[model samples]
Target: MTKSFRNLIWAVLLVTISCSDAPKGETKTASLPVYKDVPYLQDYSIKYNKQGDKLMLSQVFMDRNEVIQVASSEGILRTHDGQFLYPGVLLQDKTYRPLTDKNITAITIYKDQFVYLDDKAVLSNAWAGSLYLKHDLPKANVFAAGNDFEFLISDGPMLQYVSKNKKNWTGVLDKDKVKAIKFNKKNSTFWILGEKSIASFNPKGQTLKTVFQNGNFTSFALLHNKLILTTLDGYLEVDATTGKQIGEKKTKLPWTEITYVDVIDGHLWFGSTKGAFMLKKDGKFDYYYGKRWLPSNNVIHISKGTDGSILILTDAGLGQIVYEEMTLFDKAQYYEKQVRNRHIRLGFNATLVDMDNGNFDTGRLSDSDNDGLWTTMYLAGEVFRYAVTKSEDALQNCREAMDAMERLFSINPVPGFPSRSFERSGYKERLHDPERWQHSDDPEWDWKSTTSSDEAIGHIFAYGAMAELMDNDLKDRAIVLIDTLMSHIVRNDLYMVDFDGKPTTWGRWNPEYVNARPKMVGDRKINASNIIGMLQTAYHFTGKEKYKEKAFDLMDNHGYLDNLMWPMKDVAKAPDDADDWSKMLSESWNHSDDEMYFIGYWGLYKYAFNDTLKTKFKDAIIDHWEIERPEKEGAWNIMTALTGTQEFDLEEAAWYLREHPMDMVSWNIMNSHRKDVTFLEPNFREQTLSEVLPPDERPVQRHNANMFRLDRNYAKDGSEEFSAGDIWLLPYWMGRYLGVISAPEKNN
Candidate 1:
């Protein structure tokens, strides 16, 4: 039998199944409970400049509950200041008196009190039972507090033991120059870090011994029984008493030029010329770099804050990395506020562009080429939110975005053709792609043209979803849009024709345009998949037989089913002899197409004309998902749950949600120099590493960007901040709607 005859028979059977009690594939419900108090890292930066009244901070230490900084040359010890000041006693306030007026050469903590050595004497800030030791060690560069108000002070060569009344004892480093000093409570000795060795001074014995002699020792921190030493390159752990090498040199680090090392609360933290990092229990370092985690990349010191936070002192200022308790739902709420506050422009999800050094206040909402697609994603998210929680706020958000989408079709002259975006008139000079924008009949408006296939699929996906899961006017409105757009496409022979009487570039889905590409080309599969999904969605919502007939005609007579069913692995570079367009399209996997395909899957499988087609679409989706598993993408993994598959990488999905940095600012992130990541050879798929870095460690990007991308310095000063509307809230709300992620559990 001919293909047309076969499709006719299949269509008749579909109608019979539809009229009967045949099951329409429904999403499986899950009840995975997530609590509200789950702890996740929420990072922010506090920057300070040296030009103003802000002191040039060289050293940082936690004094009681305050983060105190000392400027050795200026003889200043005050609370460090920033745009967001650290919580503590404000020493800058007149209430907290100054310790001294003389220039301070060194400072240290003795019995929880800040002690400093000046040219005149050794003094402290302790009001009662204060310390005042008269000393002649005018060249004291470093010091550490010892027992009974005694301090072991060093001037590179000479070491003096100063007591409350006088300089009691003095010693010498025979060859090495003293760089740092730390009093070890475990040994009741002062451990000295020298330029070329490690030594200890026994205050009781008044003897200084060079415990370990090495030419590369730069810094040291005394752990319980071991001493963590730093060389110019890396760090090592050695026995405190023997000062011998504990293991092979730990040279493989985030940055090899280690500048400082310290141990706080039994955790090892390192400061390098590049950034500061902490060693986790899993042998991996939580790397903190760039302005997102530091004021400057050159880290000078690392210390534990009074509140168990890590204070990273850099050349410019301080960065405090705080861990806040928050659940995924809490983050979603935060992003929801962020979207409503700054990201919406005429109800379309928009970007804040031309920011000044990642300052959110300096940015303005801007239009984009994919405004409809982005708004569709965001609208779909709110649709799911309203469906799950019945939140009136979410319903209102959906209504606004839906109105914006509805305007895209009516604002232009082309019937049922959604514009890429619409803007107020007289912005032709400043808007993106000025040539593509055209003045509408309305004197106050202009609409962007040349809408792509992705936008069409996205619009259909959101409308179909709203029609199925929403209520009343919203459902009716969505159904009408489905019919309007699908009617236009079917009437125009499967193409979105523009006002100039031609199919828009990338809006073609006719057999001539789609089947012309090789089967291995990804556009063939994606275009076929998207159009069929759109057609299925329109037919299901509008009950339009023409949409169903066109869909089956494409699948049966035009070989669209075979085209879309091609294995994802087989999609690769086109043959060398192919046309330039085909070669360009197949050079590598387009992550944007992944976004389009997964969004299209909602319509493809959920509103299938029959259960048989639904099962086949499910298989296709799973096949694509298998290749995408390595990414561990939260959105893709959650979307895969739409097929009711048990193994959808749920843990990885949750991991992505948790690991995503709370700061969505487009900071210049650099992970290419990291030592722990396993780099992979170049390939067509653009997978840069064997394993991808956690979301917080890399640059913030939308789901359409490669997850394995290691570095992003697109704007050296970070001039843009992306909205979380489409990036974060979408996946989270989708998971909640699909029942894969449960609502926040109540505490007992």
Candidate 2:
């Protein structure tokens, strides 16, 4: 039963294979389809999905479409209701529509036209404008052998020939000297505008005759049987059929030195300014400047494809404009895709100085000083520009609000700029105060004044952003401030702003080590906030390779990077928990020192993605985020700031941002058991504007003494919102780089 059944199956397969008319010979040819000289095939390509038995083609300005079957090795075929008609050719994904489909058979694929067969297997001259419309360039094979005078323009080339009633009218008084030719259908006469003289060719007399002279004619054309000639002087129009003089009109603008003229669709478009011009049928002419439209203004050989698309050779790079309708979405999507790949990501750490609750607000959390809110205001400007280009007018109000913030920046100078002040409050003076606070005079609280680092980082970033999004007037103003700050920093050669208006070499949280002091300069390290800020500002203005080099250099020398190996010894080890020195890295008294060391590591991973440094940065970030000791909770602000990098891969960053409960808040103190401490809670009031504005203009939110805590502690059942600096950075940068936004829900 098995042997006879197998024989029967083999015989059936052979019968089917024989009837299929497969390619000849014992060996089958490669199944991959081949197409030649199709211009629009670059973006559009087709692949045969053998498993599905379908040909997938790239649709023009659309989605994918499957093909029925490919026609031949030399050409392409499309069927209407199953007839094997050579309708056109396929350039991978784009299908070129052919002129006729009645009797198409064996065909030769060409750039502009389909030199194909009728039903009788006869070669025919037929082509369609469909494929040319797709890419604006004519396919290559459209031209037959030996056609002289080819012009290459943006679209393609054109082949020109003169035919007057089937006679090659030639050899009339220096035929080679003729520069222009026109046809008068009314009288069957030809007006030849030459370099030195204008002549009229009469079909009846068959003789060379002269009418107008003086101006050297460069190019001319017959429009409605009138001879429109171009010269250095202007345009001279005459009736070619009657040989009667018409009005001679001089152009207000000088007549461009043109060499060719084409009257298409009621527009007398010609080549000049070494390019082209379109003269309206109503007698007004418009000059299109530049080779973007034409190859040259001279008769310097151009070619037109069989489908009439022009190709011209010019000095500039190839430029193309398809004479077809382009949808709005198509245009926006084109530019959007190009720019999105290069969109730079920037993240800032504002809490370098450890505040009462392991975080620092601009001033006392009780009074609304809005240093933390500035970056979001800057981000709003970016959203405004993006919205305007997209025509989303709802964002216009956001733009106006950002402008108000810029006005504040210009007027409200902190320690860095002495000329301006928002108000005479403890907040403004706190910028130069080293102590967290002091009574009345405040004695320039040194720790609070240390915020000049945070302010420099914040203001510079906002300045660059404002310059990019605003107009020239506003951008110039912002640039003045930016340049001023850069100059000041270069002059001081120090990290933080010097309180008491004197140079002091303090580095990070270390009181004895001056950042610029040569003795301790080796210990100077840039944190995530400073490094990202510098890289961003540098990238926006100079776009120099050196700025990128400096970024990579700092990341490599000071901290662990994406993939680079650093000896573990290079990292200062955590001191023994019981030792007096161990208290330096402890959350109780030394949280600020721990933050200083951790900041540089987090900044590098977020901004730099060079393959060589990625792994090392990742490992270091994971180590910092996943540490499970009790003191690690104090590291939450640093952890949250690094979360903006998204390099930790802990998956808890997103959860931590939203999970800050309403009632239970954590207090930061030198001793956990000490009642005297700073509370860290969330404050939801938009403080960015509040920082630079008067109390009357500030947005108010219900608050309590525990508002600075990460969790809600003031109200029973823990139902208060927290407005900490870290929470804002998480959602803001995440939404920016990932493009996911918690947009207000539509329809209320």
Candidate 3:
């Protein structure tokens, strides 16, 4: 450690430092995402102990195959071959002056130097074997820093800063309370994470306005201009400058008590006892834990490695994860396997099944009233798969699903009247009153008969798809069913009559019922649109004048055309009716109607019997879509694209595809507890999210639930294995079918 060698090394670094615009000591350059396509992960280990004895690895420095590791008790230089070369050796031998400080609390690779903290901080050069020890370092209660300055939080409930000029930290705030400190070099600002408030301070010793209040956070990391914090609740994203919360993120596995978060290669890597996980730039999570991906789930710390992999140091071992982005086909295939293997049943398949590896078969999947509706979506996925690849497996799946859907109508006594669901004679014997059941013309089967409009919508949707895409038997069966249903509706005054010989709760389309609502009610526009669509679809398949006649009568005489085409925003609440139904219909936008609007669009746009009506239908679709644009739903975007709407937001549609998780198992995802998400003041509709929606806000929701969810906590009952609404397959296949997305290049 001589001045001559110090000057020599500085001179040597001057050439390399001059190559970039960055200053001499500030050599840390940010990296782009390690992956640009779909991201996949692999893990390798660097265990703390080479043999049986455990080495508490606090930090590691890599130089090709040679590694210098700093453990709690000592430092070791080891080769990649599992050989410890510097056994019982020091960072500096007796030939040089050694650090006299005992109990080196920790060591880390910091900006342009290796920092070892004990009673003081030692700055060393791993290559030159030289060191600079600043013995003035305090046993700081709380400390953190940015590229230029180190901050300390003392019992004054005060703030202090240390710069290169002033080796001793001076008080930035003469007298004020502060809490935790984190500095981001990119913006040259220090963030205060505290018990009651979050505030910011600059290196110039100026305090900014408090960003947030009454907050609690356990850990946080910096991603470019944003700060990501994790608490016992969940993870959150925020802006450092404005203190505005961006959104909350949902992890695949719940992460709690996070000790650290590291932003590397444009991803957020987390360290916790639950495991180590990285929130990818694409919004998916890569969880690393257990023996397969790591030595243990008890992750303590994480650091960047030389090869762009993460250095995962646990209490027991060390590991590394190399990330790669896969092609879209790979992503689709993985989810396809999840559905085929776990989400299917012989008579009835739940939309989702248990994903717990330990008890996958115990209380797996969910029984749903919309089983027919949910099953058809999967069936439609297979139909598209068969159309694309002519796979026999896909054909069989489509056929099996059609059988379940067709059974809904036949199981009921009223011809062409589809029941909501059917079960074995006594499965629900005690739950429902005897009046709710209908025998299947046979003694063995009983079905629930008070079917809602949802079942009707689902039946026709699948029926139309099969008629247009499949073979003779399916097409004829679908056409015949359409004829029977249309005849029944026309005979019974435009309502879906239940087996009880009365209109079902939500199936009424009579003009008295549909036209009674105010012009502002979306329900008025929505009902007129749906009934007209059903009539048109019936005519398209059967070429029957009666169906076409009904469609025109509704449009011409009842003003159905005006009902369907009015702009959504212009709908006003008529003060005349304070009835609960009108109040509910007029008070807020109903995203539940969105599902009906979309499914009905298939017939409204693609199967309209007249070209003149089809053009009008196109205008209606565009009007509704324009207002829903902020939701960024893929199916709505892609389905509307089939009508040739200009600029259908294709990239955003693909983004939803790639970002939606493959694990459809309804894991518990709660966002109500996030400290970083903006919650709006209570309004009539009661909104929670202030600006934008985060990707993983809830786990395993259908497009219906996803678009409509206003609260962070799920309002529904008991957590199910599935959301019981498999929706990803529809948009994914629609993208493929519409050529908006193609299967990855054959080799890929």
What TM-scores do the predictions have?
0.91, 0.31, 0.64
Please provide, for model 3 over 1-748, each residue's C-alpha lDDT reduced to its tens digit, 9 standing for 90 to 100.
1111212221211011121432111113321111122223212233333333455544444433324444444543232332111112213212223643344555555553444555444444454744444544355334554554344343335555545544544443323345456666767787766654566766665545467553566666777777676665566678766777886554433356576677766667787766666665444455554432344566766767655546676665555443334555676666666567667754455654333321345445555667766776666666666666677876777777777777877888787787777766756542665656667777787777677666666667767777887765777877787787778888889888987688987888889888888788778888888888888889889898998888899988999999999887676565665566776677766666778888778778778877788788988888888877767787788777666554666656665665454434343444443333466665433345564443434445676654425333233222344522247777776556555555554322
Clashing pairs in 1: none
* Candidates ranked by TM-score: 1, 3, 2
- Global lDDT scores for all candidate models: 0.79, 0.33, 0.60
Q: Mark the regions of model 1 whose C-alpha exceeds 4 Å error after superposition.
A: 1-26, 29-41, 52-56, 70-72, 77-97, 110-113, 127-129, 146-149, 163-167, 746-748
Question: In model 2, where is the ten-residue run with the lowest total lDDT?
Answer: 36-45
lDDT pick, better of 2 and 3: 3
lDDT of 1 at 738: 70
Best by lDDT: 1
What tens digits encode model 2's per-residue C-alpha lDDT throughout 459-513? 5555555465555454665566555554454434433444445543232322223
Give the per-residue lDDT of model 1 (tens digit) for 362-447. 78888888999999999999998988888999999999999999999999998999899999998745455666798899989999
Off by over 4 Å in 3: 1-263, 266-300, 303-324, 347-349, 352-359, 428-437, 572-578, 673-687, 706-719, 723-725, 746-748
Better model by TM-score, 1 or 3? 1
**lDDT, model 3:** 0.60
